[model samples]
Target: MELRVTNLACARGGLTVLEGVSFTLRPGHALVLRGPNGIGKTTALRTLCGLQPALAGEVSVPPESMAYAAHADGLKATLTVTENLAFWAAVYGTDLVEDALQRMNLDALRDRMAANLSAGQKRRLGLARLLVTGRPIWVLDEPTVSLDAASVALFAGVIRAHLAAGGMALIATHIDLGLDEAEILDLGPFKARSPRDGGPASAFDEAFT
Candidate 1:
C-alpha cells in the first residue's frame, strides 16, 4: 500500500498556508517535511489524519491505516510505563506491550509511574505507542521535541526498523534523521500566497495576517 497526497491544500484558522502539496510514500519508505515555522507542516499532517479537512486535493490511503504522534506525550501520569503501554495496546487490540517496553528501553522503568520518568523517557514511552498500533503509516509531528542526542538516535533506529519492515513514515521534524530509506519534501514552494495577492482578503485571513 502507498500513501498518496495529491495537489493538497491545507489551512489553519480558515487561512490556507500550504497549497499544491503532493507526494507518494510507499512501504519501506519515509518522507520528511521541510519548511519554516508556520508553513503548514503540522496542518498538512493533521489534515492527513482527518484532524481537519484539506482545503483542496485528496489523500488516498486505506481506512484506519495511520497513527499520529504530536507534541502531546499522551500519557497518564498516574500510570506506570508498563501500564501505559498496556493501555494503548488494549486500545489498539494488540499484544505488543512487552515488546514495546523492551524496544524503548523502558523495561527497567516499567514499574515507575509516567510522572516520574524523565522527559526523554516519557517521549520514548509515547513513541512506543506506535509499535502497538499495527498501523502502516506513521504521521509524526516534531517527534524529537525533547529528546537528547542519544534518545534521538534511539528513536531514529526504531523508525529505521519500521521502514525496513515495510512500513511508511511521514515526519515533520527539524532534525536530520539520517535514514537511508528517507527522502525530503520542502514545503516552501507550496507556501500559500496571501488572499489579497489574488483576491480580496476574507475577514478571517486578515486576522491571521
Candidate 2:
C-alpha cells in the first residue's frame, strides 16, 4: 500500500493549524510526525484517517486499508482483555485475537478485565487492536503514552514486525520508538502562523493567493 499527501492543509474548529504538509509512505515503511504540542500532529493523523476533512490539498489512501489508534484506549471496561480483542476482531471481520494477545504480551492477562488493567496494559491492548484489524496501514497518535521502558521496547518490536510484513505505519509521538528507518516529518515548519502575529501571511491565506 502507498499513502501520498501533497500540499495538505489541516484545520480544527474552523481555524487552520497546519499547511503545505506532504509526504509519501510505502509498504514496509514508517513515517514519524515530530513536533511540540498543538502543532497539528493529531489533526494530520485524524485527517488521514477520514475522521476529519483536510482544508486543502490531497490525501490518497483507501479508507478500508487503514487502521487508526488514537491516544485514548477505546476498550470496554467490563470486558476481559481477551474479550476486548475478540470484540474488535468481530468488528473487523478477523480472528486474530490470540495472535494479537501474544504479540502484545497480553496472553497472561487475557482473562483479566480491562478495568483491572494498569494504564500501560490498557495502552498495550489498544495497540493490539491495530494488529487484529488486518489492515495494511496504521495511523497512531501518541501511542507510547504511559508505557514503561520495557513496554516501549515491546511496542517497538511489534512495529518492526508490522513493517517487516510489508505493513506501513504513520506515528505521531515525542518519544523515540526505536524505528531507525522511519522517516521524520517535523510539523514545526508547517505550523500555521497566527493571524495576530502580523507575519507576512498565514499559510492558509497564502494558499489562496
Candidate 3:
C-alpha cells in the first residue's frame, strides 16, 4: 500500500503544533523521522493516524491499510497476553493473533496477565498488537524505547523481514534502528512554535541520503 500526507497540519487548543508537513511512503521502504523532544513527532504520527485532528491538508490511507503504534502501551493490564491478542484479532478481522504472538517470542507469556510483564515485555506486547493487525503501513513511535540490546536486535530482524515481505514503516526514534536502506526525515531546523495560539510550521523536507 502507498501512503501520502500532503500539507498536513495540526493545531492543539488553538495552537498550531505542525503545519505544511508532507511526505510519500511507498511499499517495501522505511522512513525514519528524526527530531528532538516535543518537536511534534508524536503529533505528526497522531495526525497521520487521525487520532489527532489535522487542521489542514490531506492524509490519504485506506481504513484497513494503516496502523499506528504509539509510545505508550496500548494493552489492557488486566487481560492476559493471549486475551489481548484475541481482542485485537477480532477487531482487525484477522486470525493471525497466535501466529503474531509466536513470531514475537511471546507464546510462552500468552497466558500471563499483562500487568505481570516487565516494561520491555510490555513494549514487545504492544508491538505484537500491531503485528496482529496485519496492516501494510505501520507508523511506529519510538518502537525501540526501553528495549535492551537483544530485544533491539530482535526488533531489527522483525522489521527487516517485514520490509522484505513488502511492508512499509514510518518510525520516529532517536536511536539507530539498523535499517540499512531507510530514508531519514530529520525534523530539526524548523523554527519551533509555541503551543499557545499556534503558528504554522515549515514542513520538514530535508531528506537524508
Candidate 4:
C-alpha cells in the first residue's frame, strides 16, 4: 500500500505550523522531510502515524501498517537486549527477534540489560524493534541521534535493505543517510502563515515517554 499525504496540515501546541503539505511514498521508495527545527517535521510524522490528529487534509495508508521511531527510543531499562526485542516481536506477532539482533549487531549484548548498554547501543536496540514489527511503512524522526559515523552508515544500510525489500520510509533528519534513491521534501514552502512560539523545538517533550 502507498502512503499518501494530501494537503496535510500539521499543528503543534494547538496552533497550525505546517499547511498544504503533500506527498506520496510508494513501496520501495523513501521520502525525507526537510526543514529547519520546529517546522513541524515530527508533528507531521506523528500525525501520519496516528499518534495525533491533523488539523486539515487527509492521510491514506493501510491500517496497522506503520512503525514510528522518534527522539524517544522507547527502551525498557530493566529488560535485557534479547528480552526487549522478543517482547516487541510478541507484540507484533513476529519471530524476527534473532534477525533483528544480528542486523543491529546486538548479538554480543543480547544477555545484557538495556540500561547497561551505551547510548548508541540503546539506540540500536530501539531501532531493532522496527524489524520485529513487520510493518510496511517506517515513520522516523531524527533516527540517527547518538549514532557515531560508523553506526550511522550501518543504520543506513539497514534502511536501504528495508527499501529493497518493498518497504517504505518517511524520515525527518538533518544528516545525509546516503540513500540516493530517496526523494526529499522541503517543508519550508508549506510553513503555516499563523504565528507560532518560534522556539527551538519540533514537538511536545515526549522523549523517554
Per-candidate local distance difference test: 0.91, 0.91, 0.81, 0.90
Ranked candidates, highest lDDT first: 1, 2, 4, 3
Off by over 4 Å in 3: 189-209
Better of 1 and 3 by lDDT: 1
TM-score of 2: 0.92
Model 1 lDDT tens row, 1-209 = 89998999888887788889988999999999999998989999999999888889999985489999999999999999999999999999999998898888889999999999999999999999999998999999999988999889989999999999999999999999888898999999999888767844658867778
Runs of candidate 4 with Cα error greater than 4 angstroms are 195-209
- Model 1 regions more than 4 Å off: 206-209
Pick by TM-score: which candidate is best? 1
1-209 in candidate 2: lDDT tens per residue? Answer: 59999999888866788989999999999999999888889999999888888888898876788999998999999999999999999999999999999989999999999999999999999999998999999899999999999999999999999999999999998889889769999999998777666534555666776
lDDT of 4 by residue, 91-203 (tens): 99999999999999999999999999999999999999999999999989999999999999999999999999999999999999999869999999999874234433444
TM-score of each: 0.95, 0.92, 0.87, 0.92
Please give the ranking of all candidate structures by TM-score, highest first, separated by commas: 1, 2, 4, 3
